[model samples]
Target chain A: MLPPALSDKQTVPFDDRGLAYGDGLFETVLLRAGAPVLWRYHTDRLAKGCRRLNIPLPCQAALDATWQGDCTAELEVLKLILTRGSGGRGYAQPDEVTPRLLSRRTPFQPSIQRWQQGVTVRLCDLRLSRQPRLAGIKHLNRLENVLARQEWSDAAIAEGLLADSEGRVIEATSMNIFWLQAGQVFTPLVDQCGVAGTLRAGLIDQGVVAQRALLLDRLAEVERLWVANSVQGVWPVTTLLAADGSLLQRWAVSDSDPFQRLAHQLLGFA
Target chain B: MLPPALSDKQTVPFDDRGLAYGDGLFETVLLRAGAPVLWRYHTDRLAKGCRRLNIPLPCQAALDATWQGDCTAELEVLKLILTRGSGGRGYAQPDEVTPRLLSRRTPFQPSIQRWQQGVTVRLCDLRLSRQPRLAGIKHLNRLENVLARQEWSDAAIAEGLLADSEGRVIEATSMNIFWLQAGQVFTPLVDQCGVAGTLRAGLIDQGVVAQRALLLDRLAEVERLWVANSVQGVWPVTTLLAADGSLLQRWAVSDSDPFQRLAHQLLGFA
Candidate 1:
C-alpha cells in the first residue's frame, strides 16, 4: 500500500528533520496548464539529491498523483519538499527512515516590465561558503541564500550576486547567472558551490551555454549578462554594481540579446 | 493576551521558515526535577541568535509556563526551537513577521559508563564551512553537523571531531571540545564556526577554560581532552583517530580529573 497522498493546508509534525536540521531536499516547480514544467529536470535533481544525502526517494506514483491539486490558475508555483521524516532529538538517522513529501502552492506572477527593460544587481558582501558535498543540489539548508538576499531591501535592485570566499562568482541570491563574451556564453561551475539550477541545466542541454569558472573581477568585461531561474524565467541584467553602488559593469538592452531571446523561446516566457 | 502555550506532540504549520530555509535557532536544555538546566545560558544564546538573525524573541511568560509540561521524570531533555513563522515564497522577510515557538521533550539517559570510563573519537571527513554570520549560534541550518555525525556508525566511537576547511580544530559532532596543555585549558574559538554551547559558555564564565585557535595537528600535544554539552554533561576523550582509524592522540582518564569533577558538579551529571 502507498503512503498518504499530498494534502492541502496540512501541518508538519514538530519532529520533522527538515525543521530540526535541514536534512532534506526541495524543488520549486512552475505549473502551467495544470502540469509541471521542466519535470524531468526537477526529478533528475531530486533523485540526485536524495541519492547523495541517502534519503529514500518518495513513491513516484504518489508524487505524480498530486499534480492535479485544486489549482485552477493558469500559472502557479508548486513546491515539493522531501524531508528525512521525523527522527529523535539528534543528528543521527534512525535504523528505519521514512521520507516525508510536502507540497504547497503559491500564485505565480513575474514582472514583464523588468524582464523587458532588464534589471540592475549589486554585489553582496555575504560570501557563499564552498562545500562540494552540497554544491550543485538544492537542499533545505539555504541560510546563506537567505542572508544574502536580505542584504538589500530596495526594490530597484532586482538581485544580489554572491561570490565565494575565494572571490569566484557562484550565483545570484536566488538564481543562476550567465554572461556572453566574445560571442560565447559562459555560466559559473557549481563544482565548488551554488545550486545547479534546472533552467541552467536545460540551457546547457540545448547547447545555449557552456560551464566555466567565472571570478567576480572577470564579470566587467562580459558583453551581456543574464540571470535565469525556473520561476522567473530569464531576465537581462542592465547594470552590475559593487556593494557600495559603484558601477562595475554596464550593458544595454534591446530586442536583440540572442541568449535572452533563446531563453524566452525555450521557457515560453513572453 | 499571551500567545498559545506549548503543546506536547504538536504540529508545525507547513509555511514555517524553520523547515523552509532552516531559518531559526534551537536550544536543548536538560530538565532536572522539572527545572531547566543552564536556563540563563540558554536564554542568552537564544536572545543573541534572535538579535543577529532578526527573529523576535518569544514571550518569557509563555515559555516558563511550558517548562512544567507533564514531565515527571527526574531527568529529561527539552528542546526549544524558535522559527520565523509562515512566510510566502522567496527569501524576503514579511513586513509583519510572527515568530513561532516549538518545544518538545525526550528521555535523557546519558551513558554513565561512557562518561566515567571515557570514549573514543575519530576525525570526520566532512569539514565545517566558515560562515561568521552563522558561527557560534545554534541555528537550524545544521546540515554540516548532520553530515559529520553520520560518518561513523560504530558505537565504540562515541563522537566525531570536526575541523574547519582551513584545518582549524573547531568542535565535535554534538559538543564543544577542550584540551589542556601546560595546565592551561583552551577551546577553539567559535568565531569562524561551531556552536558556542551553553556548557562551554558556563565553563568560560567560571574561568575554567580560555578560547584559542587550534590547528588539527596540535591535538597531539594536548595533555587531556573532553567534550561537553547540556544534555550529556561531559565525556573524557581517551583516544583521537584520523578518518582512516589511525591513532592521532591518546589520553588516560582518572577519577581525580578536576575538570571533569567540576563539570559534574556544575551540571549535576552523576
Candidate 2:
C-alpha cells in the first residue's frame, strides 16, 4: 500500500537515500482497532535512531497529522520510514536536509496458530555482524536479516534465530527472543547487534525482561523460550533446530502457565 | 536525470526490497565517449555480488541491452541498481523473483585538481564493521560508508580513510587505497570489509597492486599513498589528518614519478 504522504506517487524519488544507500530508519507499528499500539515507543525509537544517525527528526506535529489523516485501517501493519531525503551522487549528507517521511499500511496476517500452539525455530547459519554504532537501532540496512530469513523455506518454521560471529545468540530474524530459566527471564543484549525491538523494550521497561549475553551452546539449559515482536506479540518456541535441521531442544510451553501469562499480557498491549 | 527505462516514474515501488531493507546490489560505471570504462570489471563484480546475495542475476542480454540503450551520454556516471524487486512485508525472499534493474546517468565531473595536485584525507572516527559474508560486494547496505563520509564536512578534504574495528586500515569512503613502501604497492585485503573496487581489482589483476592487512599506525612508514576508484581515477594523498582534524602526516607527491606514472596509466584506461 502507498504511504499516506506519498499516496499521490507510485514510487519514492529515484535519488532517495533510502534506496540509494539504505540511509534511513524505520519503525513497524502494530495497528489494532485503527490505532497504533505502543506508538510512543515506536516514535521514541525512531527519534533515537535519527539522533544517532544524525538525520533530522521529522516534527512531531507532522507525524501526528499523518497519523490522524491516514491511520484508518483497523487491523493492519503500519511501517514508517524516515529517509535522509533525495540527494546528489555521493556519500556526503546533502546540504539542505529534507527528510522524507513515508507511511505504509498492509493487511495484518496474525500468526494465530504459532502463537497458540507454539512454533518451531531453527538456528540460522548466517551470523549477525557486530556494529555497535548501528546496533539496536532499526535502521534500513537489514540485508543480514534477509539472508538469515532465506536460510530456511519451511512453512512449519515460524522464525530463525541469529547469532553474532562470536557464537553469542542475538535474536530471531524479526523479533526479540527470551528464555525462562529458574523463573528468570533473559533476552539477548542488543548492544552489539540486533534491533532493540519495541515490545522487547516495553517488557524490559515494565521489569518483565532482563538483557543478558546468551551463548548458543547454553540453549539446552533454558527451561522455556519464546520470541516476541510488535506485530506478532509472542510465540512460545516448541522446538529448536540446529543449522542442519537436527532437533536440538524442545519445550512443552504450549500449556505453561508463565508462558501463557506473559504472552497474554503482551498480546493485551498489542 | 531519469533512467531511460523509468523516465515517466517519480518513485520506485514502495515495496522495493532495495528501499525496504537494502536488499540489493549496485554498480557505478564510468562512462567515457559513450562507452563504459571497465564494463567487464563492473558487470563481473555485479554478477559476483548477485551470486553471493542469492539475488538472481539479470540476464546478460538484458544488461547489454540496457547498457547499449542507455550509454548515449559521452561523459556520464552510470549507476545500475539491481533490487530483489517489489515484495510483501517481511525479510523472506519473495516467491517469484523479478529483479528490478534501474539505470541512471549523471554528467561526469572528474576530480581534476585532486588528481593533479593530490588531495588531503582524514582518518574517520567511525570504524568499519567486519562482515566477511558481505565484504567486497558493492551491495546496497552502504550506511557505514555514509556514516564515515558524514564524519567530515570540509570541502578541502577529498576523502576519509576508514578502518575496521580492529584498527586495520580498510579503504577510503568511496575508493580503494594503496600505499607504496620500499617500491612495493599494498592495498587492504577486502576479505573482511570494504568494497573490492573495480579499478583496484584491475590493478591487482595486472600485478600492479598487492593485497595486505594495513594498520593505521604503519602509515608513517609509507613512502607514498593514493586512492583509486573507477570514476575518480587516482588521487595521491598529500596530507593525512586525524579524526579531530589534527595533521598526522604530510607528503609531497604531485611531482613523484611513481605516483604520476601509476595515475597516468589508470587515468588513460578511464
Candidate 3:
C-alpha cells in the first residue's frame, strides 16, 4: 500500500537534505474504510510546516493523487515526508528547489485494550530545548523526541511525557496531552517547544480543549488526562509515573467519563 | 569520487532514523595529497558524537575502508555520515542496531583570496536555541544552521555569525570562530550551543586557543578574528557587519600576523 512515489523500488538519495540536515517535515495520517480520515487537517498542517521551513509545498494535486492511489487498505497508517530536496554542500539551500515527497502505508493495528482500560505513562528526564522558531511544526529535527522516547523501554508504559527546560510540561513523546481539571479541558501551549498535533488542533477548533502553559506541579490537580494523536486518536492515561519510574498518581476512567467520551468521539470519526 | 558505500547507486532507506528524526552525526574531512588532513581529530569527534547520541559507532574496519578507499583525490572533501539505520516507526530506536555509513568525495576548492586578504562576515538575526544535551556534537539536527545561513544571500559575505538566545556569540554558520586580543586567542564555549569542530579541537589541543563565553559587545575589543573548519582550514575576517548589513568593525591583517601564522600552520598540515 505504498504510494507510487515511495514504492519498494524507490530509494532516498544519499544527499537528500532530509538525511543530511533533517531539513524536512512529515505527517502521519490514519485511513479508514479506504479513505484518509482528517485528510484536510493533515494537508493543512503540512502546508503550514512547509511555509515555516521555507520549503516549497508539493502540488496539492500530486499529493491527492498519491493518497487516492494508495488508500485501498481498509485500515492503514500513511506516512508522508517532504524534504528540501538535495545538493547543498553545507547549510545553504540549493539553488534549484525540488521538494521531494515520499509516502508509505502500513496496516493499522488498533490498541483496543489501551483505549478501553487506559494506559500508564512516565515522565522523561530529558527536557526539551526551547526554539520558538521551530516550536509547533512537525519538522524532522526530532532528536529531542527520540531521546525522550528512549528514556523508558517498558512495554507497559505507553508513552513518556516531556517538559521544557523551564519545567513546563510540553507534550508526550509523539502525541499531544490534554488534562481535565474541574471540568475544564487544557492542553500545553507549544509556543516554545513540542508539536501541535493534528488531532489536538481539531479538538481545539471544536472548542473541546484550551491551550495553556502547564507546570509539573499542576498535574496533581488534574482530574483526568489523555494523550492524542492523528493515528491512535486518544488514550486515557490511568497512571502517571515520576522520573524514577515510581507511580506518582492514578486515575480511573469510567464509561461516562469525559476523557472516555472524547476518546470515543475521536476514534469514531469517519 | 565517491566511496563504494555512498556512490550514486547507493540509497538511504526511507525509514532511516537519521532521515526521519535527524538521529545521526556526520564528519567532513579535508584531504591533501591523497590523505586525510586531520584523520584522528575527525574520528575522535565522530566517536564522541556517537557516544553522546547513543548511536553505536560504525565498525572501525568499515570506516577505515571508506576513508582509505576514497582518498585518491589530491585535494578532496570527504564526507562520512553515520546514521542509526532504519525501522524505528516512531521516536523509538530499533531493537537491533544496524548503523548505516555513507561517504562521498568532492574536489576541494580552497578560498585562497579569502584566506589571504580576509573576508566579510555579518551577524545573523536567528539566535540558536540552548540545548546542552545536544550542544557541541555535530548532529544532523541542523535546521538552525540552515535558517541562519539563509538570512543573507550576498555572495560578497563569506559567512554569518550566530549567537545563542542569551545573546552570547557562538560561531559562524559553518565554522567555529576565534578572536584574538592582545596576543590571547578566545573562542566561544560550545557547551550551550554550536558545533565543536575538528579544527577547533586541534587548535585547543595545541594550546593556541582558549574557550570562553563570548558576548556580542566583546567583539568591539577584538584585535583580530578568524573562522576555521576542516575543509577551509582558516579564513581571516576583515570586516564584521551588523544585522542590517552595515559595517560594524574592520581589521587589517599583515603577512606576519599571528592569525595568518595560525592559518598557515593549519593549512600546511599534511
Best by DockQ: 3
C-alpha lDDT score of every prediction, in listed order: 0.85, 0.82, 0.83
In the order shown, the candidates' DockQ scores are 0.77, 0.76, 0.81
Real A-B contacts recovered, model 1: 0.73
When 1 and 2 are scored with DockQ, the better candidate is 1
Model 1: iRMSD? 1.0
> Best by TM-score, which number?
1
CAPRI docking class of candidate 2 = medium
Write the candidate numbers in order of decreasing DockQ. Answer: 3, 1, 2
Please give the distance, in angstroms, between residue B25's alpha carbon in candidate 2 and its true position after superposition.
0.8
Which residue runs of candidate 2 sit more than 4 Å off their true CA positions? A1-7, A69-73, B1-10, B69-73, B254-256, B266-270
Q: A43, model 2: CA deviation in Å?
A: 0.3
lDDT of 2 by residue, B1-270 (tens): 112233235367878889989999988887777677778998899889988888888777767554565455567887888888888448988787777888777777776787778999999998998888899999999999998898888889999999899999999999999998777888999998899999888888878889999898997568888988988888888999999999989998656556446545764632
Worst 10 residues of 3 chain A by lDDT: A1-10
Question: What are the per-residue Cα lDDT tens digits for candidate 3 across A1-270?
Answer: 122233334457878888899998999888787577778888888888888888888777767754676455678888888888887758899887777888777888768777779899999899998999899999999999988888888899999999999999999999899998777898999999899888888788888889988898788568888987878867899999997978889998667666546645765642
Off by over 4 Å in 1: A1-9, B1-9
For model 1, residues A137-224, the per-residue Cα lDDT tens digits are 9899988888888788888999999999999998998999999878899899999789999989999999999999888888888888
The sequence of per-residue lDDT tens digits that candidate 2 reaches over residues A179-243 is: 98778888999998899998888888888888899898998678888988988888889999998
lDDT of 1 by residue, B191-234 (tens): 97899999889989999989999898887788899988888978
- Candidate ordering by lDDT (highest first): 1, 3, 2
